[model samples]
Target: MAAGEPQAKKLKLEPKQLSENVLFGMGNPLLDICAVVDKDFLDKYGLKPNDQILAEEKHKELFEELVKKFKVEYHAGGSTQNSVKVAQWMIQSPYKAATFFGCIGKDKFGEILKKKAEEAHVDAHYYEQSEEPTGTCAACITSDNRSLVANLAAANCYKKEKHLDLEKNWKLVEKAKVYYIAGFFLTVSPEAILKVATQASANNKIFSLNLSAPFISQFYKEPMMKVMPYVDVLFGNETEAATFAREQGFETEDIKEIAKKTQALPKVNTKRQRIVVFTQGKDDTVMATANEVTTFPVLVSDQSEIVDTNGAGDAFVGGFLSQLVYDRPVTECIRAGHYAASVIIKRSGCTFPEKPDFH
Candidate 1:
């Protein structure tokens, strides 16, 4: 199931079974330029291993230096983009099963991202802005760990008026059965989240939100709260879940406790139970539903097979959401999520092989 590994077998769901469900995603859109570097590269760039840093003007020279020294590979990234890609792969129909929305600059990197997404079979609807260059995330990998420097650039131009309602975008929103928005979007456009949440609510669709990172929960608390009631399915890692809990005056760092506390929050959609999925890397993934909190251990491959853990969590959400659209039970959803994560961690960047081994 590793990206470059030999195909084990052909495994896929029937096209007819997949055509009925549609998922929508809106969030930061970036082209990830990745390369393997020596451990000293981190100290040279002042980057902490495994941390996601916002790229500032000062990092421009560092980017230039990396490109000069290493072979680079590009993938369509940004957390929500990664999730949508994995979900589309799981469903086996990118055009029919998923649609992603984001803003990008009318430049070469944007063109690259658009082309790569199409190649991956995702329905990529990008709002092209002439004002800025395409955003990018420089992911430097060393010894299987990744550190990222994200340049928001034109990706941050995701305003409600500029992108959401243009042409057939609103129609796509109306037809979707599930809606997903990355937490990073809150920093750029909270109004976009509200707009999509409102529409998803009116349409009785499933609205899912990924906490993105811990800083998002800390810095964007108000907007996170504003959209929380509308989020029927909430996703976050151990760090993100604990951060949100601490922000709300909870002293506990336990994953199960965090899931319980989040699941108890009031929801706008009363008919649907609030499901909080808390993931602890290499540990059990906790699912908190109306009745109880259940834990499922991550199904990892042999340790030697784990290559780059870059998009593992996002892949998990994609896998989970892929099954969510099919009304699968929570246990099955988590299993699918784990499978997707297992595959992505075996590959570089957020890239996937031509056909995943589903068995």
Candidate 2:
């Protein structure tokens, strides 16, 4: 052994005291520019066929020219941000929420997000960076309200040092009863996730996660594996769940096995209850806890019309979290989640229903 060698200190986590009502989220904040376009518009813009495209200024200019031929709308978006917004609306109870993220140039997009948060009564504190333009997502919608293009940009710069002050923001995180995170962030910057997860562990936080996109699972196998033990509640759809199962070397066909394996993961704290919730479109949603497995049937409106499916998953997470934070029964929570998702699917974009009449 070298006598003069420096030694690395072992990381230690001590639980901090926290209230039972606050919630905090960490992720990217993006602006969504949504528009309904027909085949003519698609052809006029020369938007390549299939999957969303992230374009440069030239393409954006061309897109702008094409959109001038149709109608367009803009809204604030980002998976975690949307979830927090929906949760705030559904809870209808006074709750404190803090979001940590980077925004580009105090532009209209950033202003709109701040205004929307304020309108929803959410405490909006953000760090504005100057290197890049504010991030945006151009959602090209068809006449049927189905999204054909999701152009993402600028929102991809959330790095670890960007969250170095997170502990100082611990008051905001600890004041909240639950901490929500999205898998998309993990894919973007796992170091940022590790920073948050370590702090949440030390503070005895009820950590929750949503699989933001189906394909996120494929790119984040190791990172997800490392983060799961610190997670208290996990939300995902069928595609995400199957991807997770495959990543863990389990066959998707064996649902029971997947559930069992997921439930058996070590908990961050023994006193905490761990759960995995899988949402199957039009099929029953399944929840797995250490000692029990429950299935809740999806609630479908008698004459439901699909307007737009964007943010539906985020709405479901918001609904579930709103109920769960209040210590509602799992069954009721699942129902609330489905109810929220149903409402969003019948709307043009990610929006809260005027009323939560979940009978």
Candidate 3:
């Protein structure tokens, strides 16, 4: 599914002409507790601006502090969930255009996540449990930078047999033409990803994934390696690419070289060559295949209009997936991804307008 292959021939169809469950995404779903707070609040939590870290014992009070003292906003904030929501918004025709699967708790935060997913037109089927009280990320904003403290409460409790392997849910897996997951999910349920990726490859469908964060390559290498063979389209930023290259013993930090090597990795499914996309903030986006490396300059924004940089990567992939499901070419997918990312960076959190005005 390299954007210009025979499979891409499906691009002849309009973007909105897709059926329900056209795209399927799975990962941890977290409620984003977002608000603008002063430097004193950040110092109190021993957090610095622009830092993303798991919640520590010392930071346990931050979520409540944000809710108690500041004007906060909540948005559905998991990486895969955000992408599918953006994809649904871009497609905008058949409601429930994108289907998402994840585990959450039977708590208020989980309720909010479901409500937000519905509001975004994403068909969410969450595995609700009571042992833990939903996962959340406190997005403490100071000017343009955000400090994130995530509490992966129920997010870590995903068991494959409980949801993904069920007959009723597996039907959605079979019905989708494109399957996506964030590498962050490797921490929660790589077994579930293996199940979906194997099925997607066996069925000759497009299977895409992201190197969600740098630590994923460093800490989750075993699971990442097990599923890499089934990936047709891989997305990440230059930073994550460099980290993956170093961690996988690729021995190079140059993104073009890394992309070329990644494309050449052993793939079980021989239908198409793996295509890798690495985004460079404020520089050219690099796309690589077995034959060539191409670059696309990103849209530039003024310093005054930028609101938040969080969720830009997920938004980019969502926009790309919107076109991929429609069989749109790789170039168009990149353009749409850029459009989506640009729109999101102008707003707070991963929230988007009612409809996308993609040209």
Candidate 4:
């Protein structure tokens, strides 16, 4: 306690800067080629509705021939890409998205996807794989804008060794207030998830995970277990939640028991600071956190007219993270998520809601 004899300088560490409204998404970036076709088109190709067919070289050639027989359109899409797009639109703010993937050809489709990201006001930082073609998901639509078949390609090449740019972009993950990741990416490359999760956790950054598809859970059980401790918020539908619960020895029918088990799962690395939100189709959403569990009713739309349900879950994550980045109350975050999902359900694709009238 020296008074005036060259007092030692006191050092203070500055608090981490958190973005108020910016949201960051990490996943595959692909183009969605939406083709509106009639029954004749399906009959011509012996294709069934609501089926996702994998395309190889022969299948891709056949698809090209079929496209020549029918009219089609294109949009920028990817599970996480759609999430960031909706977030920017709903919040009407500058949101940033960083994707890790590699593509073989530097073609127009790739350029267009990058342009679309810019147009959506999302900061795009992608690593091109000089060996593989860019990934795409062909969504065949009916006259009513209902999707029939979703052909996923190029997205399969999202591997770990190809994404060395991730190291360069580690700063993006660290600087982000909230990091949104899709489960599909984890299924494709679990090491990428570990890298991002470890960095985000070390920086004390908020982390959110989307169960992009139910089938992904089947393939990603071990990887999911490894990253669960780093996750702070989890987004998934009833099917995905039930699958995860079953893995933990809970029955699907006993949703309450499932929720309890979900809440009680041990953190993988650090102290438990997590929330699990289980969304059911038009049913009440069940949320479980460490200290509390609750349900939030879904905002019902007129049953007469329902649109595509493609990116509803992604929109919900974006809305939830939008509020969470600002450190808003958990209740408000839930409400905002519900509102975003409602808007997307009323549209065809991963459309965003109107500017949030924050009450």
Candidate 5:
């Protein structure tokens, strides 16, 4: 059923059934070095405004230069990592309610990333590789556009046997009932993603993922397809849903049509129906299941309150998952998601308050 917003519930909230490591997520780990610089700085490093690319050999010195010259701030940024952090924040009890697996380096940056994740209460078990330094994405913000150049040094060095495949680590995977993997990991380690996803299907557990970005669908279609059959819940935004529809040859422009078709996509887990959710910023959020599609309107009282939308999407999924692990209704899940996004967009990064007054 469509809703102006998720229906308000009068019933008292149920007691939480959450336990440690109830939610599991894996993705690329990066220390985002964010700063604003002049156009001359972009030209100096052979970069253009509004372009996202891999750091080239010529740009190896760019991260150091940005830190030395610009007033930079570091944020623990990886799509899956951000979502996992938000989920834990929303849980607010049973500390370390979320377990996160990823590869980072045994370096100072890696240490900083560990500290940041711990501060958010996320149980991050990083595979600290010795061969490489660490992964970083330098966000160069100009007045007009933000240019991102990512160097997935140690992040790209993830070995399944060293982490996911290890019996000790697999125990964590077995312990969790729900799993979320960001689409960005499709670039780093599709094989590892498939392993975890396949386990979820075999064990009759919940598996979900985000489209991450339009380029993920455009460039990583093969890896994306390899894991789609195991996806029980899929999330994306308007453009991402549209781009994925095109990549999958759905041949439709209507989001509702795209959503329904995506919802009906092939899945190995026949035990549960797949849910396809697409958010259109302040517009209506679309959620489609095998039976019907529902749209929930988002109300923004004062557009002036939104300071940044950097991790809104991640917060949405995080909020959704926070409720989902406890078996809440989908409508309530969406409601919490909207609430979480609203809170995060008002802040600079993905940070939330001491506790959520979301009841």
Candidate 6:
């Protein structure tokens, strides 16, 4: 033993916490440029309320108009990033609790996104791609509706071989007890998603998935189905669940029927049955497992109290995943999800309150 050597201190986690208790997420990363606009503004720009459309070069004019005419706010955004941020906010551990990975350009927007994520207590592992500019998502919010237009420039540069093949990165992936990937990534890197899902299954980690949109469920069914067998917990909104069911050749949009079929899908390596949970806006939320189905009514919130619905579902996933990592019951997990969603809807553009009161 060398007497002059510096010693590293051991981190002592709680009894319930382990090396694998950390959460890791992967998806496109975007700098959310959010502003309030009128329905007329949407019509002028040819945008449909509540629809998320990928931005093209032609949409640059609309973005310029937004920045010129409205009050704009920027935040680190993307479905997976939002969920990971909320999970970090809920978990509240001094050591790293949640980590996210994606691609970003070597530009100002990329720098801003990474800084904001660190401020939210999330470990931001972003790759800097030089070929394109940083990505941005413009969110147009109205009194009762929101529309998103995304320009995924460098965000789509993440590749399985260049990013995920690094030995150091693979070590980090193997250490996570839980993993989450937004469905949007299926279009960009289904290979990476499959690799992570396979690893989670082999190691008995909880792998979660969010059906990002109805279009993804309807169009990207094949890749999603390949990964579903490895998913331990699955989330979707009513529209996504229905769309997935119909695309899979089911005859009904009934959530229970959808859940039953989803739950019956084969699982890999996991001994416990898969769980399917879908939320129906303002209606009862349903959860189905191999054994039974349970439904809980959405906690009532006045229409006037709801300010923005931009990141409500992402917040719910964050809350639920935080609880699930701690091995909470499904009912408690759903309650935590609802609580978090309730808090987010009162704010604008995926922003959180001062502190999350989970108690």
Which candidate's lDDT is highest? 3
Candidate 4 ranges with C-alpha deviation above 4 Å: 1-22, 36-66, 69-71, 95-105, 141-154, 158-167, 268-272, 353-359
lDDT of 6 by residue, 1-359 (tens): 56433332223433365343288999999999899998888998789888788887678798788889999999999999999888888787744688888999998989899889889888778878899988888999988578999888898999888888788787788878889998988978899999999999988888999888888888888899999999999999888898888888889878899998988888996576799999887788899998898998877889999988888889989989888878889998899889888888888888887678877
Clash-forming residue pairs, model 1: none
Writing each residue's lDDT as its tens digit, candidate 2 over 1-359 gives 46433332222222222233376777767777667667665666566433334455546564455358657676777778788778777765453443445444467767887777767655655656655666676666664334434333445655456544556554555566677888877756777677667677777777888766656667777887788888888888776777778877776555555776787877776667788888876778889998888888877754448777777778888888877776778787788899898888787778765567765
TM-score, every prediction: 0.93, 0.82, 0.93, 0.81, 0.90, 0.93
Model 1 lDDT per residue over 146-195, tens place = 89988888888877786786757888787788989889889888998998
Residue-wise lDDT of candidate 5 within 1-359, one digit each (tens)? 55523443323234665879999999888888888789999999989776567788999999999999999889897778889888888888888889999899999999999999998888899999899988998878775356778898988898998899899889898899889998889988999999999999999999998998788999999999989999999999998999999999999989999999999989998999999989988899999999999999865736778765667888999999999999999998899899898998777656788888788
lDDT of 1: 0.86
- Which residues of candidate 5, in runs, are more than 4 Å off? 1-14, 36-53, 57-61, 141-147, 299-301
Scored by lDDT, model 3 comes in at 0.90
TM-score of 4: 0.81
Q: For model 6, what is the C-alpha lDDT against the true structure? A: 0.86
How do these models rank on lDDT, best leading?
Answer: 3, 5, 6, 1, 2, 4
| Worst lDDT 10-window in candidate 2 | 8-17
TM-score of 5: 0.90
Error of 3 at 261 (Å): 1.4
Instruction: Please say which candidate is ahead in TM-score: 3 or 5.
Output: 3
Residues forming the 10-long window of minimal summed lDDT in candidate 4: 9-18
Scanning candidate 5 in windows of ten residues, the lowest lDDT window is 4-13
lDDT of 2 at 334: 87
| lDDT agreement of model 4 with the native | 0.66
